[model samples]
Target: MEILLNLKNRICSLGIPLHAAFEDIGTDKTVELWSEIFLNCGQIMKEQRLDAGSAWKKVISENRGLLPLEQADWDSINDFGELLGKSDRLNQESVLDMARESIALLEKKAEEAMKTKGKLYRNLGALCGAAVVIVLI
Candidate 1:
């Protein structure tokens, strides 16, 4: 989410290309995969003379098994690629903003689910430990 936000801001304010924006955002150390994805997409777009959308698709396809995203996140990412570099600057920014929003919502949902499931697992572990203690006694 931070990367997406930073990319959008950079593209909108600095008018940087998608690949450049991604490269800048990829410098962050929070997630290694994001850096790899950004660098790979940049290389694909530059070397192959492909558009941002096509380059993004290629990168995603190659890294599909390694990505830890949910279905909604994947959909948002693919959708963002479809609009990227296919329209005017304003439209590109709008697409980025929309993708950021979609990812933000997905993050919220994931956080909520984590909280709920974390409690459940903690309780389950406690119960199992109690059962084991009783059996030993």
Candidate 2:
């Protein structure tokens, strides 16, 4: 149970966005795969007297930055893929590789966002400074 709980926590922390992304895909096989993984993890957690759902909530709260699509959410998908590849229940290298690729794409997006934010801040500061100088003059 401890093992399953740990596994689930690790997976969630790594930010696979499993629930939503899996739902979006909407394939039986994908759902089955996720269900099996979650079930096995839950069974392990149950043995240890730990509630898997609660554990999931706690993990999310603690590691919110690791979530995908967030400003600080970087490399989470890759990390999740690596975790899945390492897990005994579902060790698929190809899946891990795909996830790594997804992470790279996400990282690129993050970089672009940062650049845009920097430019906007700089422009705002310049405009504010110019307005202040004109008022002082």
Note each model's CA RMSD in angstroms.
Answer: 2.3, 12.8
What are the per-residue Cα lDDT tens digits for candidate 2 across 46-107?
Answer: 45544434433443444555344563453342244223423442443344445556657776
Quote each prediction's TM-score.
0.81, 0.45
- Clash list (residue pairs), candidate 2: 1-44, 1-45
TM-score: which candidate is best? 1
**How displaced is residue 80 in candidate 1, in Å?**
2.6
lDDT of each residue in 43-133, candidate 1, tens digit only? 7777888888888888887887897777767876775677776777788778878888887888898899899999999999999999999
Q: Which candidate is the best by lDDT?
A: 1
Instruction: Estimate every model's Cα lDDT from 0 to 1.
Output: 0.79, 0.48
**Candidate 1 versus the native: TM-score?**
0.81
C-alpha positional error of residue 54 in candidate 1 after TM-score superposition, expressed in Å: 2.0
The candidate 1 region of ten consecutive residues with least summed lDDT is 20-29
**Residue 60 of candidate 1: its Cα lDDT?**
86
